[model samples]
Target: MDKQEQALGLLQAAVESMGGQVRPGQQEMVKHVVEALDEERHLLVQAGTGTGKSMGYLIPALAYAQTSPKPVIVSTATLALQSQIVGRDVPRLLESLKGKLSRPMDVSLLKGRSNYLCQYKLGGGYPDEDEGALFSMDEKPPASGTVYSPLANEVMKLREWAEHTETGDRDELVPGVSDKAWRQVSVSAMECLGSQKCPMADECFSEMARARASEADVVITNHALLAVSAFEGLNVLPDFDVAIIDEAHELQDRVTSSVAGALSARMVLTAAGGAKRHCAVNVDELTKAAHRLEKSLTGIPTGLMDKGLPEEMGIALNDIVEQSRLVLALTKPEANAPADGGRQTARSQLQAIMDDAIRMLETEERREVLYTTRPREFVDGRGYVESDPGTPATLNVAPLSVAGKLREGLFDGRTVVLTSATLAIGAQFDSVAGSLGLMGAGAPSWEGVDVGSPFDYPKQGILYVAKHLPKPGRQLSAETLDEIEELITASGGGALVLFTSKRSAEEAAEILRPRLDAEILCQGEGSMKSLVEQFAADRDSCLFGTMTLWQGVDVPGDSCRLVIIDKIPFPRPDDPISKARTEDIARHGGNGFMQVSATHAAIRLAQGAGRLIRSVNDKGVVAVLDSRMATARYGTFLKGSLPPMWPTVDKKTILGVLKRLKP
Candidate 1:
C-alpha cells in the first residue's frame, strides 16, 4: 500500500482499539496533513473537539517521519495537552503500529531548561550569597521548635526524589512543589552554564533530554520552546523538516511572549546583590540607580508608552547601564573560574537588562510597543505585603506583531500543519491566517479546511442570549445575576460561569453563593486542577472563574451541562498591546476594530461557549448574559464563530432546555 493508505489503516486501527469509531472529519484531516507534508506546503486545519485531532495528525506525521531523513516535531500550547499527547496518544498509537513501521519510531518529550533540576544548584552550589536570601531556610517556630516550614519540607522532598527520578522533570514530582520552591533548584536558559562547563555535565537532565530528542524519530515540545528555537536561534530541539502545531490559535501570543524583553527594578536589585557577593562592585550606587529608575517609572501612568521615554527616565536608564557595565567589567567569568556560575548568571541578567533598557530608550521601531505596568501584588495587595511604599514597575518592550518573524524563521524551509478547534473566526480562516503571517502578499500559498466537530451540536446544545436584559456595562447587573441564578437552578448546578474579569467573577460568586442551594467554587480558592476535580466529583456544583477557565478548561459530560458567559470577552480599553495593534491595523488601511479587537473577542467567545458540549452524548445550554450578542450589529459575526448550536433569546426556553438536560 502507499503511505496514505497505510496511514489511514493505522488511524482506523488506533481509533477502534480505543473503542472510538473512525470519524470522517478525522480521515479528511489525516489526508490533508499527508498532502501538506508531501508537497512541503503549509496547511491550516480547523478540527473541532472530539475529532480525535491528535491521531489525525500523528498518524500521517509518523508515516512521513519513518521515511524522512529528519525527525518530526509536534508542538502543543499547554503542558496538559503535551502530557495527553506524550503520555497517552503517542503511546497508544505506537503500540497499535508496533511492527508496521518501516523503521523504529522513537519519541521524546522535551521542555524548557527551567523545568529540569540544575545539578549544580542541587549540590548546594548557589550562584551567590543573595541567592540564599531569596530562598531562605530560616523559620520562626512555635514553642515546640519543630522547625516547620513549607519551603524547607519541599526542598527536602525534592532532594530525596532527585536521586531516584529518571528525567528529573518537575511534573513527575508528587504533590507538586510551588513555583517559589522550584526556583531554588532550577536554572533558566540564561542562567545555565553550558553542560561542558558545568561540574554536573555528565548527568545534566536538560542536556540528556536534548540528546534523546536528537536521536528520536518524533519530538514533542511546546510552542514557547518552538519559538525559542525558531526566533532566538537556540538549539533547544532537534532539527526537523516537518512540524504539527496543536492548539495553533495560541501560537502568535506565545511567540510574542517568547521574543519580548523586559526590565524591572527587582531584576536590577537582584543582579546588584549577586555582584556584591562576588565582585568588588559599588552595590550601593547600583541600588540607588535602580531605585531612581523605579521612582521615575512610578510617576508614569501604567500603560503603553506611546511617546518616547521621558527625559528623567532616560537619564536613570543611562545611569543603570553605566553601573551594569562597571560591574560586568570587574566580574569577568574567566577571572572567577570554578565558582563563576553565579557571576555568569548575574552578568547575563544585567547585560540583558541593560540591552532592553537601551532598546526601549533608543529604538524608534514602530513595530514594537513599550509599556510599564506594576506587578499584580502591588496592584491588588493579594499575595504579599509590600515593605516599600514605592513598588517598582516593570517596563516591557515587545514586538507589535510576530507575523514577520514567524514567516521568515518558521515557515521558510519547512512544512507546517497548524490545527486548532478555534482557528477560524466567523466561518473563515482569513483573520487567523493574516495574524499568523500566512496571508500577506507574496507569502507561500496554503490551504484551509474545516473538518468540523463530531458532536451533533444543534441537537445536543442550545445557545441562549438574554436579549431582554439591559446591555452589560462594566459589571454584571442585578438582572443578569437573577438570570444566572434562574439558569443554574434549572440546570441543577452543573454549571461553569466564565467572566471577563476577576472582579466580575468574585462579585457574581458572592451574590450567587448565598442565594443558590448548590455548592459554588471560585477560581482563586484553590489550584485549577483541584477545583476542577471538586467540581467534577459533585453533581450539584458550579464553578466561577475568569480568563484561564475560559479556554483551558475541558470537563465533559453532565458535570458541565451549563456554560454561562457574563459578557462578550473583549479587549479592555486600556490594554496596551491590543490598543497598539488596533491602531497599526487602521494605519495599514484595515478595520482595526474588527480585525484586531472583534476577532479576539470572537475566538474567546467561541472558546467560552465550547465548554458546554464536550462529548457526543453530552447535552447542555450556553447562555450569554450580554445583550450585545443579539442586539448589536456584530452579533451575527460573533455568533457565526461558534458551533451550530440551537439559538434562542427567550429565557423561558433556555430554562426549559436546562431542566430537561439535568439528570
Candidate 2:
C-alpha cells in the first residue's frame, strides 16, 4: 500500500484496538490534516463535539513528527486538556503507533513559570517582598502589616515538595493547593524573574519544561501561555512543524484577553512601593499618581451603570495615564542598581497598564452599547461617582489583527493546525479565520475540515425556546424568571441556568431558590471547581452562573439534565473595547453587531449546548429563554449553529423528556 493507504489502515486498526469505531468522515479529516502539514499549509479543522478529534489530529501530527525535522506543537485551551494530551492521550497513541511510524516520538507539557513551584520561595528567598508572605506561613494567618512576611514558612514547604514531586505540575499536588497558596509558588508573567537572573535558574521547573519541549515530538500548553509566547515573542514552544489548536473556538477571546492589560490604583501603588526600594526619587510622585487616578476615576460610578463609556471618561483616563508615566519614569532606578530587578518589573507593569490606557484614549470609538453591572458604587453623592462598593471599573479590548503578530512574532513560518469543536459559525470558516488574521496576505494555504460529533444531537436532545415570552428587555424580564422557575421545577434541579450578566444570574437564582427543591449553587459563592463539584456530587443540584460558566463548565450524564440560557450573549453597551471594535468593524463597512456580537454569542451558546450531552448516551434539554430565537431575523442563524437537535417550542414536550431521564 502507498503512504496514504498505510496510514489510513493504521488509524483504522488503532481505533478498533481501542474499542472505537472509525467513520469515513473522521478518516478523511485525519488524512487532510496530515496532507496539509506535508504541503506546509495552515489547516482550520472544525471537528464537531464527538469526532474523536484528539486522535484524529494526533495520529497525523505524530506521523509527520517522526519523519519531519521539526517537532509539532499541540496547543489547547485548558490545562485539563494539556494534561490529557501530554499525560494520557499521546502516551497511549505512542504505544499504538510504535514500530509503525518512522521512529518513537517524545511528548511533553510546557507551562509558564507560575505553573511551577518557585525555588526561592521554598528556600525562603525574600520574606519581605509583597508575595513573600505566602511562603511565610503554613496556614491562613492574620493579615500582617507587611505583605510578604507572614507566609514565608508555607512557601518553603511548597517549594521543597515541588522539587521532590515527579510531575512538578501544580495539578498533581494532592488536595490541590488554594489559589492563594499557589500564588506564592507560581509566578505571573509580569512578576517572573527571567531564567538568567532568577536565583534558582539551574533547577528551574520552567527551564526543565522547556528542555523537554525542545526534545519532544509534540508539546502541549494552555491558551494563556500560547498567547503569551506569541505576545511576548518568546521561543518557549518546541520547534513545531505545525500546531493543532484544540478548542479553536476560544482562540479569539483567549488571545484578546491575553493581549489586553488592566490597571488598578492598588496595583500602581504596589509597583510604586516596590520601586521605592531601589530609586532615590521621591515616593511622593507614586502617591500622587494613585490619588490623581482615584480623583479622575471618582467621576464615574462603579458597578453596572447604564451609561456608556463616555469620551470625557476616556479623556480622564488619559490624564491618569499621563500622571502614571510621570511617576514611573521618576521612580525608575539606575540601570546598574542592585534593586534594578524590582524596578524593571515595576516599569514593565506600568508600561502594560499604560498601553491599555492609551488604547482607550486614542481610539475614536463611540459607546453605543452599555452593560449594566452591580459593581460597588463608590460615590460622594454626585449620582454615580467611580468609588462604589463592589463595583470595579474594567475595560475590554480585542486586537484587530493578530495574524501578522503571530506569523512575524510568534509562528514565523512554523506549521500550525488550528482545531476546535465550534470553530465554524453557521458553516463559515472565514468568520473565525478572519478574526485570527488567518486571512492575512501571503498566509499559508491551509486545509479545513469538520470531524462530526459522536452524539446524535437530533435524537438525544431537544432545543426548546420560550417563543411565547416577551422579547427579553435590558433588565431580567419577569417572564424570563417565571420560565426559569418552571424549568428548574420540571427538571428537578438537574440543570445549569446561564445568564448574560452576573446580576441576572443572581436574580434568577434568588427567584428560583425558594421554589426549587434542590441545592442552588451560584458562581460567586465559591470557586468554579467547588461549585461544579457540589453540583456533580448532588444529582439534583442546579448551577446558576454567567459568561465563563457558559463554556468552561463540564458535567456529563443525568447530573445535568437541562441547560437553560437566559438570553443571547451580546456585547454590553459602554464597554470601551467592544465599542471601539464595533466601530472599527463598521468603518470597514461590515455588520459590527452580526460580526462581533452575534458570532460571539453563537459560539458560546454552542459550547453551552455541547456541555449537556458529553457522551453518546447522554440526553438532555437545551432551553433558550429568549423568544428572539424565533422572532429575530438572526435567530435562525444562531439556532443553526447549535447541535442538530430535535428542536421544539413546546414546554410540555421538554418536561416529558426530563421526566423520562429522571432517576
Candidate 3:
C-alpha cells in the first residue's frame, strides 16, 4: 500500500490495540495534515477535545519524516503539551509503528537553554547577589538579607542529581524544584556562553539536545523556542521542512512574550553585583545609574509610552547603557583570572544583562511598543510599585504585532498546520487567521477545516446563562454569589469556577466556603498542579481560580460537573499593550472592540466552558453568571464560540439538571 494508506492502517491498528476506534475528527485531521505536507501548503485545523489530535498529527508527520530529508518540527504552546507529545505520544507512536514504518523515526524534544541545568552555572559560584545565595556558604551573605533553608536543601539535592542524571533536564527532578531554586542552577539563552567558549561544552545539556534535534527525523519544541528561532532569526533550532503548531490559539501570546524585553532596577543591581565580584569593577557607578533610572521612572505614571518618554527618563536609560558598557569593557578577564566556571559564568551573566539593557534602550523600532508598569506577584496578584520603598517600575518593550513576522518567517516556503480546539471564534477562523498574520494580501493561500468533536455536546452538557441576574458590575455581586452557592449546593460540589481576576476569585471563594457543604480550593492556596490533583482526587470539591484555570485545567469524570464563569473575560482597561493594539486596529479601519476585545473574551469563554464534558461519558453544566451573555447584542457572537450544548436561562431548569447529575 502507499504511504498514506499504510499510515492510516497503522493508526487504525494502534487505536484498536488501545481498545478504541479511530475517531472521525482524528481521521479528518490526519488526512488534512498529510495533504498539507504533500503540497507544501498551509492548513488550519481546529480539532476539538477528545479528537486525539496529538496522534492525528504525529502519525502523518512521522510517516512523512520517515522518507523526507528534513525533519518535521512540532511546536506546542505549553510545556505540558510538549512533555505530553514527547514523553507519551511520540513513544507510543514509535512502539506502534516499529515494523510498519518505511524507515526509522527518531524524535527529539528541544527546550530553551533555561529548561536544562547549566553545569557551568552549577559548578561555578552564582553571581554575588544572584538567586544562588543558598549555595554559597563560603562567601559573604547575600545582600537581600533573607535566608531560605528549604532552598539550601533543594540546591544540594539538585547537585547530587546533577552528578548522576544523564539528561540534566530540570523536569526530570523528582518533585520538581521551585522556580526560585531552579534559577540558582540554570542559565537562560542570553546568559549562556557560546558552547565553543565553555569548558563544559561537551557535556552541555542544551547543546546536546540541539545536536540530537539536528539529526532526528522529528523535533518537538515549544512556541517560545520556535518564536526565537523564526522571529528573532536565532539558529537554535534545526531547519525543518514543515511545522505543526499545536495549541495554535496561544501562539500569538506566546510569541509576544518571547520577543518582549524588560529593564528593572532589581536587574541592574544584580548585574552590577556580578560585575563587582568577577570584574572587580566598582559597583557604585552602576548603582548610581540604576538609582537615576529608578527615580526617573517613579515620577512617570504607569502606562504605555506611545507618545514619548520623559527627557530625563531617556537620559537615565542612556546613562545606564553607557555605564554597563564601560563596566563590561573595564572588567575584561585578567591574564591570571581564576579558570573556575564561577568566574566565567559570572562574566557571561554580566555581559548578557548589559546586552539586554542596550536592547531595552532601542526605541526607534516603530513596530514595537514601550510601557512602564508595576510587576505583580504571580501567586497573589499583588502589585509592587515604586512607592513601596525599594520596588522599582519596569520598562517593557514588545512587538505590537507578530503577524507580519510570523507570516514572513514561519509560513513562507514551509508546510504549516495550525491546530487548536479554540481556533474558531464566533464560528469562524478569520479572526484567528488574521491575528496570526495569515490573512493579508500576498499572504500564502491557506485553508481551514474544523473537524467537529466526537462527543455529543448537546447530549452531554448544558449551557446555562443567568438571564434573570443583574448586569455584572466591577465585582461579583451578592446575588451572583448566592446563585453560585446554590449551583454548587445543587451539584454537591464538583464545580470549577473561573474568574477574570484574583480578587474576584478570592471573594467568591470566601463567600462560598462558609455556605457550601463541600471543600472550596482557591488558586493561591497551592501550586496549580497540586490544587488540580487535590481537586481531582476529591470528587466533591470545587476549584476557584483566575485565568490559568480557564485554559490549563483538565479534570474529567465526575470530579468536574459544573463550570461557572463569573463574568466575560475582557482585557483590563488599563492593560497598555491591549489598549494600544486596539487603538492601532481602529486606526487601520478595523472594529477594535470586536477584533481585539470580543474575540479574546470569546476564546476564553469557550475554554472556560470546555472544562465541562471533557470525555464522552462526562456530563456537566456550564453556567455563565454574566447576564450580558443573554442581554447584550454581542451575546450571540460569544455564545456561537462555545460548544453546541443544550442551552437554558431558567434557573430552575439548571438547578434540577445539576441535582440529577450529583453523586
Candidate 4:
C-alpha cells in the first residue's frame, strides 16, 4: 500500500481500538499531512474540535517515523496538549500499529530543562572546585511560621519523589508540587551546570530525557522550546524531517517572547550586590552604575519609546556595561583558584544583564519595538499585575513582527504542517497566512486547508449580537450586565461569561450573585480545574472569567448552553508592540488597524465564541453584548471568524429561545 493508504488504515484501526469512529476531517488532515511531508510543502490545517485532529496528525507522524531517516517533531502550545500527545495519543496509536509498521516506534516528551529536577541541587551536592559552580532553575518555598506549611510540605514531597522517579519530570508528580517548591530542585538552561561539568550529569533527568528523545522515533515538545531553537539558530530538538505544529495560532506570540529581552531596576540592583560580593576590584564604580540605572528608570512614563531611550537612560546603561566589564575582569575565574558556584552564577547573571542592556540599546533595529512598563506578575493569562508606586519601570525589547523570523528559521529547512481551530480569520486564511509569513514574496511556499468542524454550528448554536446595548467604555455598561442577568435567568444557568478584564467579571458576578437563582462560580476563586469541575457538575451554575476562559476549556453538553462576551478582546489601544506595528504599517500606507488590531480581535473573538458548541450535541447561544460587534464595519469580519451560528439582533427572540432552555 502507498504511505497515504497505510496511514489511513492505521488511523482506522487505531480509532477502532479505542472504540471511536474517525471523522472525515481527520482523514483529510492525515492525507494532507502525508502529502505535505512527501512534496515538501508547508501546510496550515484548521481542524475543529471533535475532529480527532490529534490522532489525525499522530497517525502520519508515526507512519513517517517508521521509515524516515529522521524523526518527526510534534509541537504543541500548552503543557496540557503536550501531555495529551505524549501520554495518550501516541501510546494508543502505537498499540494499534503494533507489528503493522516497518519497525517498532517509540516517542519521548521533551520539555525545557527547568521542568525537570536537578539532583545536584536537591541533594546540595557539587562537583569538586574545578567545575560545577552554581546553577539551579527557579523558586523558593514561602517562609513558614505555623506548625504546617503547604509549600514546605510540597517541597518535602518532591524530595521524596526524587528518589524513585526515573524521568524526574515535574509533571509526573500527581497533584503536583508548587512552582515555589520545584524551584528548589530544578535547573534552568542558563543556570544549569552542563552534563560534562556537573557530577550528577550521568544521572541528570534532563540529559537522560534528551538522550532518549534524540533516539526516539517521534518527539513531542512545546512552541516556546521550538522558538528558542529557531531564533537562536541551534539544535534544541533532535533533527527532524517534519514538524507538525498543533495550536499553530500561538506560534508567533511565543516566538516574539522568546526573542524578547527586558532590563529592570531590580535586576540592576541584584547584579550590583552580587558583583560587589565577588569583585576583587573597588566595587564602588559598579555599585554607582547600578544606582544610576535604578535612578534613570525611575518615573519614566510607561509607553513606547518612539524616538528610543532618553539620553540619561542611554548613558546609565552604557555606564553599567563598561563598569560591569571592569568588575568582571577582576572577578574572572583564576586557573588555579577553587570554583565558587555563587561567583560563577553571579558572573553569568551579570553578563546576561549586560547582554540585555546592549540589546535594548539597539534602537536602529526597525523590526523591533522598545518600551518602558511596570513589571507584571503573569498568571493564567489573567491577573497580569503587580503595580505599585515603588515598582520601578522596565525597558522591554521585542520583535515588531515574528513573521520573517519564523519563515527563515522555522519553516525553511523542515517540512512543516501547522494546525489550529482558529487559524483562518474571517473565513479566509489570507490574514493568518500573511501574519505567519507565508503570503509575501520570497516567503516559503505554503497552502491552507480548513477541514472544518464536525459540529453543525448553525443548528447547534446561535450568535446573538446585542445591537441595542450601550457602547462599552472602560467598564461594562449597565445595559450589558442587565442582558447577562436576563440571559442567565432565562437559561436558568450554565453560562460562561468571558470579560476583557477581571474587574468586569467580578462586578457582574457580584451584582448578579444575589439576584440569580442559580449558582455563580468565578475564576481565581480556587483552582481553575476545581471551579470548572463545580461548573460542569451543576448544570445551573455559571462561570465568569477573562482571557484564560476564552479558549482551552471544554465544558460540553447542557452544562454550557450559554456563552457571553462583554466585549471584543482586542489588543489594548495603548499596547506598545501593537501600536508600533500599526504605525509601521501605516507608514507604508497599509490598513494598520485592520491588519493588526482587528485581526487580533478576530482570532481572540473566534476562540471565545468557540467555547460554545464544543460537541455536536452541545447547543448554546453565544451572546456578544458589545454593540461594536454588530455596528462596526469590522463586525462582519469578526463574525466570519466564528462558527456559522444562526445570528440575531432580536433581543426578545433570543430571550424567548433561552427561556425554553430552562429546566
The best candidate in terms of TM-score: 1
Better of 2 and 4 by TM-score: 4
What lDDT does the true structure give each of the candidates?
0.84, 0.72, 0.84, 0.82
lDDT, candidate 1, 1-663, per-residue tens: 866788888887787777878899999999889988988899999999889898899999889888777889999988888988898888888887777777668889999999998888887665523344335433332355666467766776777788899998998897899887888789888888787678888899999999999988889999999998887777888998889999898898888788788887888888898778656566787888888888877756677887868887888889888888888787776733785576767777778887787777764654689887765432342322223335566888888888887887788888999999999876699988888889878788889999999999999989999999999887678998999999999999999999998877888888898899989999998999899999888878999999999887788879999999999998988788888899888998998999888998998998898888888889888999999999999899999999999999998888888888778
Q: Among all windows of ten consecutive residues in candidate 2, which has the lowest summed lDDT?
A: 366-375
Q: How do the residues 114-218 of candidate 3 rate in per-residue lDDT, one tens digit apiece?
A: 999988777763452244455455444345767568878677777878989888888888888888888888887766766766678898899999999999999
Q: Candidate 2 has what TM-score?
A: 0.84
lDDT of 2 by residue, 198-275 (tens): 667787677788887888777778778778778776676765557778888877677766776555565666656655
TM-score of 3: 0.93
Between which residue pairs do clashes occur in model 4? 133-341, 134-341, 138-183
Q: How many collisions between residues are there in candidate 4?
A: 3
Estimated TM-score per prediction? 0.94, 0.84, 0.93, 0.93
**Residue 646 lDDT, candidate 3, scale 0-100:** 95
> Number of clashing pairs, model 3?
1
The reply for model 1, stretches above 4 Å from the true place, is 128-148, 283-285, 377-391
- The clash tally of candidate 1 reads 0
Off by over 4 Å in 4: 125-151, 278-282, 334-340, 375-391
How well is each residue in 1-663 modelled by candidate 4, as lDDT tens digits?
A: 887998899888888888887689999999999889889999999988778888888888888887787878999988888998888877777887787788888899999999998888777642222222222313553456633356556666787788799999988999887676777777667667666567678889999999999999889999988888777877678887699999888887777877788887678777777666655446677677777777877877788988888888898888878877777777787665553555665677778788788877775664678888886665543335646646568888888887887788788888899999889875578777787788788988888898988899889899999999888998667888889999999999989999998877877888899989989999889888898888889999999998888985799888899999999888887799889989999999999999888988988998999898878788889999989988999999888888899999999999998988766
Report lDDT (Cα) of residue 17, candidate 4. 82
After superposition, the stretches of candidate 2 with alpha carbons farther than 4 Å from their true spots are 1-3, 127-157, 280-291, 300-398, 401-404, 407-412, 440-444, 524-527, 530-541
The best candidate by lDDT is: 1
